[model samples]
Every structure is written in C-alpha cells, then in structure tokens.
Target: MSALTAPHLNRWLIRLHRPALFVWTVVLLGLGSALMCLWGPLADASAEAWQQHYACAPTGPCLYDQAAILRYKHIYDYATMAVLAVPFLVAAWTGAALIGRELEQRTAQLAWTQGLTPTRWLLSKLTLPAALVTAGTGLLVLLHHGMWWASEGRIGSAKSWYDPPTFYAGGPITVALALAGLFAGAFAGVLLRRSLAALGAAVVAVGALWAGVHQALPHLWTPVTGVSSLESDLPVGNGVDVSTGLLTADGERLPDPFCGSTINPQCERLYDRLGAVSWYHDYHPLSHYWPLQLTASAIVLAVAALLALAAFRVTAVRTRGLS
Candidate 1:
C-alpha cells in the first residue's frame, strides 16, 4: 500500500478487531456509569443512612460523605481505573498477537515477500489502537472534571488538575502508559513467537510498572498534603438532629441550619459549647502530578520503543522454514 493508504489500512485493522474492542469498551463504560450513578446518591445521603445502606460501620462518617467522596483522590482513582485499565489490558493482548501470531502461523514470510516494510507494519498496528485509547481517556478526564466542578463545596478537598491523582487517574499519562504496554507487548510477541507466553510476560511487566511507579514515586517527588474537618450536632430522644457543613484549610465553612439557632435551647447550648470536631491530614498527588506522570510514561515508552526496534532488527523471513 502507498503512503496515502496507510491510514486506511490502520482503520481496516481496527475494524477487523472491533469485536474484541467493542466488548472491552462496553465493560469499561458499564463500570464507569455504575460508579458515576452510585457515587452521587451515596454522596448525598446522610452518614448514618449510607452506613445502614452499605451495611458497614465506619469509625466516623464514611468517606462517601458528600465532602469526602468528591475529593480528587477518590474520584480520579475510580475513574482512571475504569477508563484506562480495560483499554490498556485489551491493547496489551492485541499487541502481543501482532507479530507472534503471524510468525506462529507462518505468515511473516508471505508479508515480507509482498514488500511491506517492518516499520510501516508496526506503525500501522500501533497508531489506530493508541488513538482509540487516548480518545477514551480524554473523555474520562472531562467527565471527572465536570463532576468535580458540580459538587461545589463537596470537592473543596479534592485534588486539582495539577494533582497526581489527575495525572495518573485518566488522562494523557494513562494513554501514554497504554501505548507503552502495547509496544512492549508487540516486541515481546516478535521475540517469543508464542502468543500466550508473550501475553503473560506483557501482562506481568505492565502490572509491575504501573503498580511500582504509582506506589514508590509519589513520596519521592512532591506529594499532596492538606487538612479537612467536619462537625455535626448530636440529637437527644425525639429531638431534631443538626449537622454542620464541612470546613477545610481555607476556613470557609458551609452554611449550617443549626447556626445561630436560639429556639432550640439544647441546640443553642451545644452551639455555644464545644462540639464534635473531626480533623484529618490527607496526602494526595497534588504537586507532582505532571512531572512524575510524564517521567514515568517516557521511561516506559522509551523501553518499549527500544524493544520494538530490537524486534525489527532480529525479525527475518524464512523461505523454507517457519519463523
């Protein structure tokens, strides 16, 4: 195929792979939609209601409380895992079959004889899937941003776009990580010439890289640190229960119904008296989001590219025997 036809061929390849991709996409969309719907109701419900509904007793209010659930750390965690992991996993499997299946089935020689360059072949295989993954991740990022903004005061303690959760949670870093895995898996397939074994190796390597970087690098670089507090009124028998809005580092507290209430003597007395004040110190990826994400992604990409190059160098057409 001519240079102008390369994109068409890539699209064709994607079309051919649509069955698997569609299944994976449906699974991802289902997971994301479920979380999006569930988190909202959970956030709006009272702490006691949430505990009773979920059938778990938290030490204090559950993190699903409106103020806490909207936090960037938690939001990004769920969104990113849902949006990125499925595509990456699917791509890794597809990539592992890129060359290994051809070699295993003795089709490499026929393609080589047809004058298809290895570089063009590999590029064609990588570009379409990578683009699909990037687009999906971008959508997920936008969704998280919209949700965070809508939550208003609830998201006061959430990480910002520059936060690590945002970086690793489902954005450019996720796309890059998936691309890296694709390339690495493709390279392993070329080297191993066995689809299953290559796939196993690729999965292990990708998992290790993702987990290791996420766990070890956050502390080594800039970390997110902040304070959050919540206060609520306790009710006596048959009395009204009052709750205060959460307070954050900015010292802005939400409007509480019990504030300045004089009619209820007990409520007024409790207001004057010291109430239950809960404070917590949380570490999120607020500062080092981009730098660490970029650095890690680049490292993985570089390794993958080098492996692909090595595979290209070693690949040879077998005239009378299997590759």
Candidate 2:
C-alpha cells in the first residue's frame, strides 16, 4: 500500500468535518464582531450615560440614557458567557464529531488499514483542530480583555478585573482551558468509542477540571495580609478574598465573630470576650493577576498533556491487534 502522507490525512479529516468547521468559523466571527462593538461604541455610550447620571441633582428627579447603560451591561455579560463556553463547545465537538464519530463509523479503522498507523491517524485528527481551537479561543479572549479594559472605570456596571468570569474570559487561561478540553474530549472518545457517551464524558471532565481550578486558584499563590485595629472596619479591600478573620493579641488567627465594628458597644463587648484585637484579611491583589493566570494555565496545560498521552496510549492498545 502507498503511504498516506500527513497532508493527505489532513485533507480527508477536513473534508469529513466541514460542517463543524463552518459552525466554528461562524461562532468566532459573530462573537468577535460583538466584542469589537462592545470595546468601542457600546462602552463609550455606557460611559456617557454614567457621566450623565453623575451630573443629575442629588434631590431631584433626573433622566439619563438608562437603556444604553443596560444594553452595554447585558451585552458584556452575554459575551463573557459565550467566551467561557468555548471550552465546553470544543469538548463536545471534539468527542462527538472529530474522534468518536470517526471511530464509531469505522473510518479510523479504514485509515489504519490503508498504510496509516493508528498513531498517525490520531495525530492527524487532533493537529488541525488544536491549532484552530487555540487561534480562535485566543482571539476571543483578547477581544474580551479589550472590551473589559475599555469599560473599566467608565461604565458603573462593568465587572471588575478580578471578577471570576471576567477574569477567565479575559486571559490566556481560557485558551489553556480550550486546549485542555480538546484533549479531554479526545481521551473520552478513544476510551468510549461511542459518540454520544464520549460527548457527555468529555463535557463532564472539562466541568470537573474547571471546578478544581476554581477551588484551588486563590491558594495557588501566597496572599497578602491586611491588618486593621478592631476600632476600624474589616481589613478587606478591593481584591480576591481568601480569608477574613480576627487576630488575637499574640497574632493568632481566629474566625470572625461577624459582629459590627468596635464602635458598636455590643460588638465591642463581644470582641473583648473573644480576645480579638484586630481584623486580618488574606487576599490576592490586582497585581497578582498575571502570576495567578500563568500559574493556573500551566497547570491546565499539564493536565491536557496528560490527557493527550492517555488518548494516544488507549488508541495504541485498541489498534494493537490490527497492527
């Protein structure tokens, strides 16, 4: 049999998945356009509305372009959600269409029999899709970041940089998550060999992975501690809160009594009884954003590599007899 080169295999893979390609392209273009609109016109309109709102008299009825502000907020929310959903979409498509369907239809087997090794077939299936997913996801993420940055401090309702959804959608971490979802779906497809089952498993796997990352993110970096006297309000600031509690005279951290400030006579008495001297906040500042994002992304990419390795191993085992 004549050798099936990489270009030939890639052409066949693209032909087989043309519909999926069209859908992905449409999604990218539509979302990118929305984000660009948000970054420029939508943000500017919302900012002007907020300026008008601030100009209104304190004690009199005033009118502002509420619709423009609400529209900007709604569009930003919807766009952020769409950016975050890319991973799940990639997971489902990779498992069901890219890998699982091919295996289920015996197309993979045919390729393996036609002078194409199972490993080469699997690589061909993944390579183009990974490249496309990365580029598309990265573009969306960059646009989301630009939109958020443009609205920052201008629109009153804009989500903060530290907001979880905004943070995920506006960084390279989303790109990592997309790639991880790709490998996870590929792993599920190779393991299950059924399109529907693989699709569910892949989505669930990505969900679980994201949950794990969310839970562990704050602890991934050492947090800055803010301390304040009991006479002051809580030491919490505009940052990601990891922990907030009371500190003893000896600096021992203790659970917060949830009482009001020491100016409140009743709360002061309670704090005296509890031997609480001050409030302490352990949190990540905005300065830590890049470090946290890079750290989390590295962890996700490592997991993706493992998943890819497992997919290849499973494929080898399944096709060993044919070889």
- Give residue 16's lDDT in candidate 2 (0 to 100): 79
Each model's total of backbone clashes: 2, 0
Segments in model 1 whose C-alpha atoms lie over 4 Å from true places: 1-8, 31-80, 145-167, 219-285, 316-323
The alpha-carbon RMSD values of the candidates against the true structure, listed in the order shown, are 13.0, 1.2
Residue-by-residue lDDT tens digits, candidate 2, 148-253: 8888788889898889999999999899999999999999999998999999999999999999999999999999999988887677567878999999899889
lDDT of 1 by residue, 130-216 (tens): 667567655665555555444434433444554445446534556666666776677667777787777777777677767766665
Compute each candidate's TM-score over C-alphas. Answer: 0.57, 0.97
lDDT of each: 0.54, 0.92
TM-score (C-alpha, index-matched) for candidate 1: 0.57
Best by lDDT: 2
Candidate 2 off by > 4 Å: 1-3
